[model samples]
Target: MEILPGEGVALVKVGEHRDVVESRIGPPVHPGRSSRAVYETSPMLVLTYTGDETVELVELADGDGDGGEEVFFDGVQLTSRFMDDVVADLEAKGYEYEETDIGYRFEPGFAVFSMGSRWARDLDPDAAEDDPRRVVEGVSVAPYEYFAEPAEEEIEAYISSRQSGGNR
Candidate 1:
């Protein structure tokens, strides 16, 4: 799918019909609320639909919790190589973005660009560590605290640790 600027995404407008979204993308894995729903097109790629029936956002759960989620405009199956291409395309189109430890946050209009890897811990309270699948599998796009800004020290530490080939 081609990503147009803020005007329209994929084949659907930012705030358009739900049927178009379903037809283009397919039904969601979980039941939706009156206002929003989430679709897991792949283990690592997720799509968000608003109450108004527009595809609001797309998120990629990176290996660590630092990068920003992005506004998804079109459907694309994700793999390591495919993600790189998508990010490059978004950049080529002049999508303004910010860097984080985990990923990049593109400037968003249809949806907020931000990271969700941190939320993996919440899904398994008793586990010794976050399930790695949480970052590689699907994630919920609900409004949550996972997107909060990290402290400067925390960000620096994460980068340093990653650079040193240490686990975070």
Candidate 2:
């Protein structure tokens, strides 16, 4: 699968209906709630739909290493590359990003989450250099605005809803 950052992943562009996705990729192995589906692709594919039943987000996550499908961005293989190396490449390419607790959120609607490498105290010090936990655990693509800070009104609405038990 090819991740096109803010656009989409491979042939599954955002804004496509669920029916179109099912027709293109066949049925999902795990049909989730009304808004989500999971395909058992090499690295597992997850599609999230909006209330209108249109694709809103595309995510690829690590699966059992049976090694069938490979996810790529630019020319780099995302599922197998180490997070440090990936970040270095991103820097070289001049992409602006914010470092999160788990991984990185690039400004171009791309976010990567890393495995629990930092908490793996039992790992060998030498092997830590190539630790599997350093690889990306999952990656998601959405609209550029998805990464933007929420508007004050949106935040206030959320707080008010929570206070009133409307979000509970």
Indicate which candidate wins on TM-score: 2
TM-score of each: 0.36, 0.79
- Model 1 reaches what TM-score against the true structure? 0.36
lDDT by residue (83-148, candidate 1, tens digit) is 345556667777665544544444643222223434435434565564442222222232222344
Query: Which residue pairs clash within candidate 2?
Result: none
- Score each candidate by Cα lDDT: 0.45, 0.75
lDDT of 2 at 157: 96
Give the clashing residue pairs of candidate 1, or none: 35-51, 58-72, 66-102, 67-102, 67-103, 68-114, 69-114
Candidate 1 local distance difference test against the native: 0.45
Model 1 per-residue lDDT at 55: 54
Q: What shift in Å separates residue 147 of candidate 1 from its native position after superposition? A: 10
lDDT of 2 by residue, 51-116 (tens): 998999988885424465667777766655567777788878887888877788888788877766
lDDT of 2 at 6: 87
Specify the poorest-scoring 10-residue window by lDDT in model 2. Answer: 117-126
